[model samples]
Target: MLYNIIFIALFIFVIYVFYKKYSKKAKTIPPHWHSILLKEVAFYKNLEPSEQKRFQDRMMQFLAEVYIDSVDFEIEELDTILIASSAVIPVFSFKEWHYPTVTGIIVYPDHFNEDFEFSNKSESRRIAGVVGTGRLEGKMILSRKALRHGFSNKTDKGNTAIHEFVHLIDKMDDNIDGIPEILMQNMNAIPWLKLVHDKMEAINNDKSDIRAYGGTKQAEFFAVASEYFFERPKLMKRKHPELFKMMAECFRVKF
Candidate 1:
């Protein structure tokens, strides 16, 4: 009876700990932040009031969990709001989804070089955003300017924050070669491959609306197409129905 009593007590303790942890995580956001999201992010503005509330909830959860800090420029409310929105948009369809591999986000004042090391001799190319790997895994870097630019205009179908996070998501399957293994069923793999190849070929031939960057590689194609999928759903659907359907299935979101 003593052993049974100890086990019950331990279970109750674990439940209590989890309850408190979750309750603390669900803290409400300030009204001003909601206003900022509405004004700054087109995605947030397009959501219904109820959906807006849900988005805010998810944003708050992300802010609470993710360590967002600035490198050179002072981070503002809008920056965090928009960054969190970018993270939320891709996985918004799944209520319980969270970016497990992404532990933190670093925002630089502007685009940085490949190694991001400031040295006159280093010949690194400037880039907007990059996902961390190797020893620096679980981290992501973004340009503050690019973060704002993503929300400032809704027509470009390009978002640096979303682009990098999609790369992170693509990495979940132990491969970042454009195939999202965990989310896609085995039966759909071949068709997905064919579509990726054909569309990439079209982009190479300049016969596709997908950015030329997508023609670079399979992984780049997935990330670039995802940008179009979320940012310009109508154009994507009208122009390329099959690619749109594939994106929809990959994300489980219609738009």
Candidate 2:
């Protein structure tokens, strides 16, 4: 009897804490939003019915907490869902995960350059997304067209939003090194580093199937490889089994 009472109390406390975390309480995911998720979001649609509800609740919570605004283009409901979905996919296994580094998201109508200019006339406008620093800290800017393109194609095995969000996750330990100390324990550090180095060599030598950008640096490698992991889990596992396992451990989820 005493144990049962204690268990009930603990359960209630957990629920209360979760409720207090987001007191703003997001509105229900509208029918239109449901349709969008069902049709557009492969990860959400593939989840079990109960898990899909959980995913929706998290999406609503994110939408409530993180304001998505447009710079020069009108964002559709689909765009909003895509942004939130990108944020959710990486940390979905954690019940209380949040993007502490991101305060607001600014979406440009198209690609931008180092100066944040997105006009098509600029030949140097090549950047797809960037996490802010300096005066622009606590903000993330993304190309709306690139954002849509990330999800539109599954064959490329890349998602710019996911890549950027993984960077945020990589920064949680206050270090932007390719090694995510938060996700990687001290014991696994050497193996993870060695594995990263070897794979980077393959990428640099044009022998690996991973993207070439990953070979540029460890931080970029982690983000780029994360994109490949989430977008094409089966292919990654079949080709790079070790990297696949480490990524699964890092995200605490496997597709």
Candidate 2 CA-lDDT value: 0.87
TM-score of each: 0.86, 0.89
What is the C-alpha local distance difference test score of each model?
0.84, 0.87
Q: Candidate 1: how large is its RMSD? A: 4.6
Model 2 over residues 176-228: C-alpha lDDT tens digits? Answer: 78987777763378889899999999999999999999999999999999999
- Residue 171 in model 1: shift from native, Å? 1.4
Pairs of colliding residues, candidate 1:
none
lDDT string, candidate 1, 2-79, tens digits? 999999999999898655544546568888887788788777788889999999889888877678888866888788
